[model samples]
Target: MKILLMLRDEFYQANPGLIEDAKKLGDVRILYTDQGIAKDELIKEVKDVDVILVAVVKIDQEVIDAAPKLKYILKHGAGYDNIDVEYAASKGIPVTNAPGVNAQSAADHAFGLMLAAARNIPQKDKEIKSGHWELSMGTEVYKKTLGIIGFGAIAKAVAKRATGFDMETLVYTNHRDLAEAEKLNVTFVDKEEIFKSSDYLVIATSLTAENRYLVNQETLSLMKPTAYIVNVSRGQLINEMDLMGALEEKWIKGAALDVFEVEPPINHLPGMREVVATPHIGGATFESIKRIGDLSIANIVKLMNGEELEHVVNGVHSRVTQR
Candidate 1:
């Protein structure tokens, strides 16, 4: 089997073991490119490859159509939105992701954002840097209500951390995991209630068509004026324009975001004081990268050996039979 690794240069450097393990399994090829490997280039790259591992690169129908020998696709992280899942399914190419690999790291980052926003950490730091002292009063987390938008692994981790701070946790998910919620002592509440009552609202859901603009203007209007919001999930989950409006009108006190609708150009949005933005570094920690790399390699090796994968996003047996 021939395996192609499509990742950034930094990731390649940090996870050298992935390349070595792939080499042991088959003829391994690594392409460190941020130009995103155009459809034609992807076709040429995967012409003779049996598997392709992708990060943020787009893997649409054109690329899938070009690779006849492609057996499986491994996404570096949990989100598979970059891949054409339906097309990959039709082509009988099973796709898998390293789910729960970076759950702790992402949850930690989400909490970091929450703390920063709640306590006005960034604003105070900025004031001190400018030679101002004892300028701002920040809110406390204890006795505050934390509303978690999604009840996934990351959300569970966040809830666990929040409980230690003596904050009440509320969760809202379409397909509620009652057992897990109860186990975490997370109060399962309606979305509107969460929006209205939360002192700190954290978004930890995956991006789907149904939730592209889950936190829109209408939803933002429902939030408390003193509340803070944190988003560590997909950027598009919150409408940027709507968020900007909220911040400008002081509908919400502040927001800390790790992801954005248009990354790198996130600064173009107004309301710098009200919004704390990071360049999508929720899962960029060394520990998380290593875990994701190792898990991705394991999934790839399993697929090559015709064994069951650990986290197959598409139906596992269906792909095998179709292929």
Candidate 2:
């Protein structure tokens, strides 16, 4: 087996142990890219690779079609949107992601954003650093309502942490998972209720065709003028222009985002004081990276051994036959 690691050079540089470890499975090759490589280079590098371990790079249909020996595409983290899963499925290549591996890190970052926005932490830090001794009023999390847009593993983890601050949680998901919600002592509500009731609203959902721009102008209109919003999930969940309008109009008091519709967000995204933005680092913690790496490696080992793969996201099943 020949494994192609389609990851950042920094990642390859940092994890020499992982490279040595991959030798246990196959002859591993490292191909670095800043999210994506040129089509020609990608085609050249991917040819005859048995497995591709992808890190944030976009593996489109063109690249997928060029790889004749490719049997598997393993995602380093929970999101597989960067891969062309439908096309891969058509070609009988199984695609899998390391789900729940970074849930704790992601949840922690979401709460960090919530507190940062609510307390004006970033601005105050700047003021104090500039030799100005000033006090800024920050909102107290105690007894406040926290609305979670999705009640998945990460959202559940956030709700669990919110308990330390004595928050009341309301959740809005496609379908209510009543048992889990009850376990967390959270209430399930409609989308509008989530907007109306939360003192701090955290967008924790995945990006899907149906939910793209889920928090648009109309949804923003429903939020409290004093409320704060935090997004730790995919950036396209909130419409950027509508968020800009909402901030300009004070539809919501403030926002802290770990992801953006466009990375290294240009234009008004970087210029707004009402917004606190991160370069999509919600799952970038050291612990999360290690966990993701371990899970991804385990999947690769399973694939090479002709065993059932775990965390298969695109409905591809076990290749191992039971006769």
Cα lDDT computed for each candidate against the true fold: 0.84, 0.85
Best by lDDT: 2
lDDT of 2 by residue, 225-246 (tens): 9898899888889899998899
**Cα RMSDs, all models:** 2.8, 2.5
Tens-place lDDT digits, model 1, residues 1-323: 78899976678888788888888888888897654455677788978888889887788898888888888888988888989988888777888888878899999999888888777788788889999888567888887999999988899999999978988999888869888877788898998999999999999999999999999999999999999889999888988889888988999998999887765453555347787777677887788889988887777666755678887787743233121
Collision pairs in model 1: none
- Those runs of model 2 whose alpha carbons end farther than 4 Å from true positions after fitting are 8-10, 13-15, 318-323
lDDT score, candidate 2, position 235: 83
**Global lDDT for candidate 2?**
0.85
Off by over 4 Å in 1: 33-40, 126-134, 316-323
Task: Please report, as a residue range, the 10-residue window in candidate 1 with the lowest summed lDDT.
Answer: 314-323
